[model samples]
Target: MTSSTQAVELQSFLSQITDRDKGLTAACAAIAEIGAAAAEMAELIALGRLYGSIGAATDHKNTDGDVQKQLDLIADEKFIAALRRAPVAVVVSEELNEPLVLNEGAPIVVAIDPLDGSSNIDANVSIGTIFSILPVLPGAGEPTAHFLQPGRVQLAAGFAVYGPQTSLVLAIAGKTQIFTFDRRVGAFIRTSADVQIKEDATEYAINASNYRHWDPSVKIFIDDCVKGADGPFGRNYNMRWIASLVAEAYRILLRGGLFLYPGDHREGYADGRLRLCYEANPMALVAENAGGAATDGHRRILDILPASIHVRSPLIFGSVWLVDLVSRFYADPHFSPERAPLFAQRGLMRG
Candidate 1:
């Protein structure tokens, strides 16, 4: 753990890691470039409408078929440009339909969501950039082949949240650290060197509007949570839905909670909306490093291999205990104590 008085800069921290592990030299460089881009993005986000309708819709649609926003395009350009200066061989971005090769023989490949939570852009809510870095395979046949490996092999993963304060949450070398952007010094200052998610929490976040579309297991979990102190879990629970993954994740890391975006019956959302490579995988790495857990209801998010660059996956992450409970619901449909008549009036597990 780092003391507040130490005041480590982001670049200094990355440099120290590179010095210790020469193998991570390229990955550390890439992360530094990403932080630089994020700092610039924070400035633009602060400008908001003064930047001339940054939230306005663009005619272009992303690879996922979601309409692109003006800020999305700009963010993509900024990050791609920054990555081009680093030792990056290829970039798989949410905005681009195909993987872009920046350097044929570079040491690393990056998968990124340049602008996450664009839906909240116009509303002036929190949004962020998510990225995962992987080593370029020695004999990889194609550029896309570099990204097919499971999330566990990632060299580094992190996200930059542009909210009340620009914050960077990173997972590298089996550790999770946080940095706050200090505009005065034009750099990120390390705030927390070691972050651990609490094992339990009283809060949960999910889109209640999708309740009708969820599977029985997910419905049962939420139902019990809604019952509060009388529920099978036997504790009062608070609900939250920010419609922004990064914001939700930041909150969970700070305090503790559960955030579920499970696959539902909706046509385009059967596999869940978040992309596997850029969004879910990176977030899963960060969560796990912070002592939390992440899964796709039945399986670990880090274990799932991406069939394609743009494939989607269900995401349920946060407090380890809460995540485990949700997994139990999915693993055994009949395991719902709330559905049993014996526990109708009171919870099976008491506080």
Candidate 2:
């Protein structure tokens, strides 16, 4: 456990690391730049309405066709400008139509969601910035190629939550760490060097309004949870839907829970809403590093190769047991409470 007095500033902790590998070093440098930008954004968000219509929708639309909020554009510009000063060779942002080339010769590429959950800006909810850093492919001819690699090749991945107390959750060097932004010191201080997700949790997060559109497998899994103690799972459960990815992820990391954003029958949402390169990939790395798991229903998130930087993917991540159970629901049609009489009779919930 890290005591307050013994807390290490993020830069000092990065500097103290002995592993001098070029990719890791470059990734750390990029993270430092990202952290700086996050701090500025956090301060801006703290001002709320004083910042002037930050949640107001703009005439512009993002790459994914979602209406851009005032704060979203500000965050994209801030992060892009900061990455220009880092060692990043390429940058893929949700706000941009194409990848931005920062430094052709740099060894690392960055993919970012500059301002996630901007829809909650007016509602006084938590929002965040998500980033994934990867080493440039050896012979890649285009900037987009740098981001096409699978999530497993990422050197570092993280997200910053701009909430009551700004926090950064990162996966690097085979460990997941949490840092709190200390305004007094104007730096992030390590709070948890190693964060482990509990193997069992009674909470789950999803948008229940979409239940009718969800696939049968997804519906079956959720049905059992909704049944509570009388269900086949035989355990009471809590449901959460904050409409903020970073906020949900932060809560799961601190405790334990399952979060699912699955593909449904709705138009434009069949692939799910989360972007694979920037959002899902980074969160998956953080979850897996913390001894948790992530999957796109039937496949591991880290193993899937992204076809494009802005491609959307179904995301399910959390405690190992819960995540794996969801996968089982997808793999075996009869593994559900309604279809499998044996499972229903035996009660599939495990400690």
What are the lDDT figures for the candidates, one per model? 0.91, 0.90
Best by TM-score: 1
The true-structure Cα RMSD of candidate 2 reads: 2.7
**Candidate 2 residue pairs that clash:** none
User: How many clashing residue pairs, candidate 2?
Assistant: 0
Estimated TM-score per prediction? 0.95, 0.94
Give the local distance difference test score of model 2: 0.90
lDDT of 1: 0.91
TM-score of 1: 0.95
Off by over 4 Å in 2: 1-6, 18-22, 336-351
Alpha-carbon shift of residue 322 in model 2 (angstroms):
0.3
